[model samples]
Target: MIKVVKFGGSSLASAEQFKKVGDIIRKDETRRYVIPSAPGKRTPKDTKVTDMLYHCYGQAILANDDDDCEEYQRSFEDLIEKIKERYQEIIEGLSLELSLDEDFKVIKENFSKKIGRDYAASRGEYLNGKIMAAYLGIEFIDAAEIIFFDEEGNFDDKKTDEAVAKRLENLERAVIPGFYGSGPDGKIRTFSRGGSDITGSIVAKAVHADMYENWTDVSGFLIADPRIIPNPKAIDVITYRELRELSYMGATVLHEDAIFPVRKEGIPINIRNTNSPEDKGTLIVEDTCRKPRFIITGIAGKKDFASITVEKAMMNGQIGFCKKVLEVFEDNGISIEHMPSGIDTMTIFVHQDEFEEKEQKVIAGIHRAVEPDFLELESDLALIAVVGRGMRATRGTSGRLFSALAHANVNVKMIDQGSSELNIIIGVRNHDFQPAIKAIYDIFVNTMI
Candidate 1:
């Protein structure tokens, strides 16, 4: 069995943290294929190494008279030097007697002079990878050489697959950096924020590992935010569909698009805590997974939303009413989040920010395109998503959710349940988000526990 372990920025922030990660990795040999993220903040007041690089390079773009690029270079050097010093300290602290050479001095010096923003941003992972490999005495492989991107900056799966396959075919284990792959022009291109999560999935797919372990700060995916619901239930196992629904609403574990590559291979990903390895964490898997006793897995939600309601007689029969309502959104550069409707009324959910600066135009567009006797716009709304795969298999999950909310004296404004039955989204007053989630979680999870 092979495990591809990807450490988040927090796990690899300093030499001390690096030593902890090393001990975790060394505890099990199956954790051979490793992915490292750039060092993150050592303290609340400190800035991330990657963020510093971005600001430094961006300053270079805007450096008029200050010639701050050189100064930016010093901050950059300080960040890297700090990272190196941390690693060297880890090695010394652990007394590993490892060679921290062949990097930073020669290879890094040349690249710093002619590096693009993506390359600069990627150095966090590169520096962390070097330190981790040196501390662990493992082979260090650059991700840019393996993770391939196309001309338009989209990832090239075919080429990346072939490269990673060939690279890891002979070698059973090594430390590979995450994020920032090579572009078609041989320059560097990076995935958007949380790109390291994407890199871990890609590598998991490339090597066909049995499981991918994402070691981060959290123990696992919780049913609800602790701030919202104290002692929230932990989802022992969740299907991809359930996870996706909750993630979109506001689940904070992995990026919403991070599991695409490995999803197809049927490889399960574990969200583990580097600080607390004993925790079972959360197991994300395909629909075929049969573990977990809860009929409703988790609840996640976000605040600050607006809902536009349109009502017209014979609305269900009207051919162009839906199109006109959507056109209103399209014309005003607004995107609808959820659409729940009845025979004569339809509600379009949208982020408050989308409507804040452009609500009048949207309302005017609706009036002009699809005039209705009853049209109303409401704001200061929150959406709570209750997710579970088993909810579909067994009935009454929706009934239980509404009943729970009712008992808690929480008023729900709108509800949208997909045809897939994986999640039920309920719109409530922004003030009710916390109580509503806690109430529902208590009924579904606490009753079982």
Candidate 2:
């Protein structure tokens, strides 16, 4: 069985880390295609190679106009040397007869020309891929050749898939840099940060691999943010839909968009840790017949939300009432997060930062469109999503949730559950966010255990 493995920056941070990765790959002959990210922070205080590239590029941009151009040039040279040293250290540690001199010369020339930040950011993965390929004695395939983007800078999925499939079909093993592709103009373009995950998924789909293994610093995704819930339980297996709910609510391990490409092909993604290869990490699949271990799969939440409540007698009776109110938000370009309603009241939840600038306009639009008798706007609200497929089979999940919060003296402002019974959302005051999560976790995860 063929496997496509993608290693995150932390997994390839240092030569020591690279040694660990090399062992993992060598042990698994089926792992033919490799995707790698730039070197990440080796320690808590260390800077990432990507960030250093950005800084160096930024310095190059400013050197053109600086009064002390000579000094600025010297600084730029220093930064480039540091980046080379990072790669050189890895090469020396791995005992590889590889030289990145020509690559660095080209990169320095590009930086001098101010060839866009995307190009600057992409060099991290590009350079790392070269090192990875040499260390493994495998062919190096530049992602720009296989991944395609449209003129608008959006990924061209069909083109990318077609190109990647044809390119890798004949190759037994290759290393493709993650996070970058070529646009219509043949200029380098990058995805948002942490896009290596998306690259892995794309390669997995193109190759139709049996499984996609994502190697990172963490063994797997945790039930809750470890910072919020001390030593949170690790999720062994999660479905695509369930992961979406948790990711949307703020549980981040895998990139949310990464699930799409593999999901369409019904490919399963195994999130593994490089440091602890023996431990089986979280498995993300399209669907599963296996029952969840807990009543709820995971809980995640976000803070700084504002709710606008439109109350009018017989409001539910009026046709297009909700539509008109929603249109007002749509017209104002504010994306509504949630809209839970009663017979006479509808509360529109939105990110506070997005709504603040156009608050008066939206309020006025609501007044003219819906003509509610009372309109109240509240802010500093936090939304928590308790998601699980098991909740559908088990009863009193909501009762237990509310009971836990009440016992913790946390007041719930709003509650919304999807028709799928897959997840429940509860809004609480910003201050209660941590406590609310703790209470929910204790009830759903701890009590169940």
Candidate 3:
């Protein structure tokens, strides 16, 4: 069995932290393949090394106007030197001899396209991978050599599959850097934000990893936000659909797009805390391998949503009513979030900030265009998502959820459930986010799971 473990920056922040990481991996022989991120901040006030490099690259491009090339070269070289210095310090602190001098290749001076921020952001993983491989006495495989993109700025799945299969099939135990890959033009390219997570997932899938562990600072995903619900229970196991709903509503443990590759192959991705490995972290998978235990798994919510409720007799049956209503948002360059409708009324859910200055104009436009009987705006709205896989086969899940909320004396404002039945979203007052979350958690996770 093979395990691909990816350590976040905070997990590798200091030599002490790196020691902990080494201990964790050594304890489990299956954790043979490792992916290391650039060292992250040890404290709140610190800045990430990747951010510094991006700024240096920005300065390099801005000052290339002199034509003598010294300014650009010096600026770029300064960033490169800083990268090397960071690794040097880590190696010395850990009392390890890392061969980064040969691996750390400088970006060519006159290269016209610097490959955008992806290339700059990806160097963090590259440098850390170099240090980690040396510390572990393993080979370092550059991700740019394996992950590929087309000339038109698209991911080449076929090429990447072949390259990763060929490469991993040959290596026994190695560290592969995450984030940037090579495009068809043979330059560094990257995916969307959190590309390192994407890269790790790709590697896990390629190697057919038994499990993919993501090590971060936090213990794991909670059933609800602690800020809203004090000391919410931690989720030990969650399904892919349930996690997607929680992520959509502000869960931050795992990047949403990072789950696809592993999910496609039915591989379980574990979100664990490097600092406290003994704690059971969240296990994300397709479905319950054990049993149907709970009616609901987690609750998450976001604040400051504003809703515009429009009411007119037979509004759903009216000709061109929806088009006219949408044209007002189109004219203002605003997009509706969720539209819950009925025969007489429809409420458009949008961020409060979006309608800050244009509420009056949008109202007037709707008055003249759609001619609704009444148009009113509700602010300070918070949306909560109650998600689980068990609810799919369980009857009265929604009824149970609403009953729980009602028992807590929390008045529900607007509710929406996807026909998929994986989750139910309820809107409440921003002031009630805490009580609502705690109330739901008491009924669902604590009582049921």
Candidate 4:
């Protein structure tokens, strides 16, 4: 069976880390394709190679624009040396006879020419991919050659899949850098941060791998944010639908975009810990027949949302009422997070940051569009999602959730649940976010113990 493995920056931060990764790959011959990120922080205080590249590139841009940029030039040269030293140390530690001198020369020239930030950011993965390929004695495939983006900078999925499948057809083992691809103009373009996960997923789909292993520092995804619930229980297996709900609520073990490609192909993704390779970690799949160990798979949430409540008589009977309300938000360029409505009451939840500046305009728009009996706006709200497939089979899950919050003295401002019974969302004051999560964790996870 073929496996596609992607290692995060922390897993490949130093020579020792690289050695650990080498062993992990060598142990599994079926792991034919490898994806590597740029070197991450070596220590808590250390800087990531990607950040350093950005800094260096920024300095280069300043030097080109300003005639009196001697200081910026010096700083740029220093950063370049520092980046080189980082690679040199890894090469020495691994005792590999590889040279990046020519690559650096080309990079330096490109930087001086004011190459795009995407190009600058992608260097980390490119440099690391070279080292990884050399150390493994495998072919190095540049991601730009296979991954494709359109003129508008949107990822061209069909083109990318076709290119990757054709390119890897003849290769037995190869190392491809993550986070970057060539646009229609042949210029480098990058995804938002944490894009390497998306790259790994794309590769897994193209090759139709049996499993995609994502190695990182953590053992697996936890049922609750560790910060909220100390040493929270780990989720052993999670369905893609459950993961999406949790991710949307702020759970971040895997990139949200990463789920789509592999999900369509029905390939399972294993979240493994590189530091502790023996751990089974979390297995994310499209669907599963195995029952969840807990009544809830995970609890995740975010703070600082604002809610607008519109009250109107005979609202349920009014045609185009909800549509008009939604159109106001759409015209104002504000996305609604959740809208839970009753017979005459409808509440719209949105990120506070997105709605704060345009509040008055939206209020006026709503007044003109819906002509509600009363309208009220409230801020400083947080939404927590209790998601699990087991929730459907278990009775009184919502009752237990309300009980937990009431016992914790956390006021619930709003509650919404999807028809699928896959997730229940509760909105509370920002300050009660932690306590609310703790209470729910105790009810669903700790009580089971």
Candidate 5:
């Protein structure tokens, strides 16, 4: 049983952290393929290596266009020295006989060559991977060599899967740096922030690993945000659909799109805490027959949403009415989050930021499309998702949610549930977001405990 372990920035921030990771990997021989992120913040006040790279590259760009670029050049040089010092500190701390002098020279020259910001940012992972490979005494495989991107910059899954599978099929152990694959031009291209998770998932799919272990700072996801609900219960097991629901509502433990690859192959992902390996953490699977511990698995919510309600007589019987309404949003380049309807009324929920910019255009488009008898727009709304697999089997889950809110004196604005009964979405006022989450947590977790 092979396990592809990916350590986040915090887990590989320093020599001490690297030692911990080394021990974790060495203790289990099956932990073969390793993915490493660049060094993250060593302290609360420190900046991430990736962010520093971006800033440094920003100075480099300014230096190229400006007539008086001495200051910008100096600033870029200082950041480069700082970054090199960080790696040197880690190398010395580990007492490794590795020399990064040549790599640093190449990086400095590449910056002068204007190799693009992707190349600049990717060097963090590249350099860190080298350090980790040397420390672990394993073969280092650059992500650029295996993870391929198309000419359009979109990831080429077929190309990447074939490349990674073929390359690692015979190798017993290796370290693959996360983030930044090779583009069609053979230049570096990076995924969005928290992309190492994507790299790890891709590797897991490539190897058909039994499990993918993601090590981060937190132990696992809690039923509610800790800031809102103190000491919230940890989720032991969650389905991919449930996690996606919560992630959309703002739970945010892993990258939103990272679930796709491993999910396709039916691989379970274990979100483990590097600081506390003894903890069971959270397991996210595609599907499960195990019963949930409570009627709801988790509660997550986001604020600043606006809902557009359109009412027309006999709307349910009217063909293409809903489609016409959706077309207005699609035409305006806005995405609808949820659309819940009644016999004669239909409501569309969207992010307030997206809607506020094109409100008049969207309203005019909707008016031209449906010509509704009544139209209303509600803003500053928050949608909370009460999600669980057990919700389908248990009755009164909605009742309990409403009761909890009512007791907390938080008025509910709208409620919608999917047919699968896996999640119930409740819309409330923005001011009541925290209170409503606390009330729901109290009903689902505190009372049970």
Candidate 6:
């Protein structure tokens, strides 16, 4: 059995964290492929290495200007020196013979040449992977050598799979840096932030591993935001569709994009904690017959939404009326999140931040297109999604949800549910968001007795 494990920045933030990660990997023989992220914060006030690199590179770019070239050059060099010192400290703490002198030399040269920001940001993961491999006595495999991107900047899945599969098949064990791949021109390109998770998923797919383990600071995903529902239970198992729904509403532990790669290959991801490896954490799978502990799997919500409500007589009989209304939003570059309609009324929910500037133009366009009898715009809305597969089997879930909200005295602004019965989205005033989530959790979880 083979397992591919990826450690987040928090898991390898310091020498102490590195030692913990090493022990976790060594304790399990099946963990043959490892992925390491850049160093993160040692304390709440500490900065991430990737953020530092970005800031330093910003200074390097400014150094090209002749007006203050000397000042910017010194500033950039100071940041570089700090980076080097931090790595040296980690090396000393681990008592590793490896010296990063040549690595630092190459970085200095790259900064002088201004290779690119992607190259600069990726150096964190690259250098960390080197240290991890050396400390573990395993081979170091660079992600750029395997993961490929096309000239258009799209990930080349077919090309990457062949390259990565063939390469890892020949190796017994290896550590590959996360978050970056090589472009068609052989220049480095990076995924979006939290991309190390994506890299781990790609590696797991390439190796066809039995399971992919993601080690991070959190034990797992909670049923609701702990700040809202104190000591919420951890989700034992969640399906890919359910996870996507919750992530959309704001429960973000794993990068949402990370699910696609291993999901297609039918590989389950185990979200584990580096600090407490004994906990089972959360298990994400494509499909499962396993029963959920509660009628609702999880609750997540997002704020700052505005809804446009349009009412017209005989709207149900008027075909294409909704399409015309939606086209106005599309033309204005605003996307709709949810649309709950009655026989004569329809409300379009959109992000307030996106709709605020163009509200007048969009309203005018809708007036010309749909010619509704009455139109109203409301902002400062929050949407909460209660998602679960078990919801389909459980009757009166909606009734119970409304009951909980009424008890909490939070008014419901809107309600929508998919035909699949996988989720129910409730809209409330921004002030009532947290209380609504807590109320729902209590009815389903706390009051279970």
Q: After superposition on all CA atoms, what RMSD does each candidate show versus the true structure?
A: 2.7, 1.2, 3.4, 0.8, 1.1, 1.1
lDDT of 1 by residue, 259-313 (tens): 8888999999999998898897998998765756787788888999999999889
Q: How many residue pairs clash per model? A: 0, 0, 0, 0, 0, 0
Model 2 agreement with the true structure over 42-97: per-residue lDDT tens digits: 99999999999999998888886684778788888999999999999999999999
- Model 6 lDDT tens row, 85-138: 888888888999998999989888887778999999999999999999999999
lDDT of all predictions, in order shown?
A: 0.83, 0.94, 0.82, 0.95, 0.93, 0.93
> Model 4 — which ten-residue stretch has the worst lDDT?
60-69
Best by lDDT: 4
CA error at residue 51 for candidate 5, angstroms: 0.4
TM-score of 6: 0.98
Off by over 4 Å in 4: none
Query: 294, model 1: CA deviation in Å?
Result: 2.2
| Model 3 local distance difference test score | 0.82
- Measured against the true structure, the TM-scores of the candidates, in listed sequence, are 0.91, 0.98, 0.87, 0.99, 0.98, 0.98
Candidate 2 residue 299 C-alpha distance from true site, Å: 0.6
Index of the highest-TM-score prediction: 4
Output the better candidate (3/5) by TM-score.
5
Off by over 4 Å in 1: 59-114, 289-291
Query: Candidate 5 on 127-232: residue-level lDDT in tens?
Result: 9999999999999999999999999999999999999999999999999999889998999999988899999999999999999999999998889999988888
- Put down candidate 3 lDDT per residue, 1-449, tens digits, no spaces: 99999998888877888899999999999998898888888689876777776776676666554557677767877777776677787899889965667655654342234546667777778888878888888898998899999998887777887898789897889998877788877778877756677777888888889999999988888877877676877778988888888898888777788898899989999989999999878888988765545567787778899999999998878889988988998899887777888889989988899888898899998999988898889999998888877778888878877898889888899898888888888999998877888888887777754
Query: Candidate 6, which segments miss by more than 4 Å at Cα?
Result: none
For candidate 1, which ten residues in a row score worst on lDDT?
A: 59-68
TM-score result, candidate 3: 0.87
Worst 10 residues of 3 by lDDT: 106-115
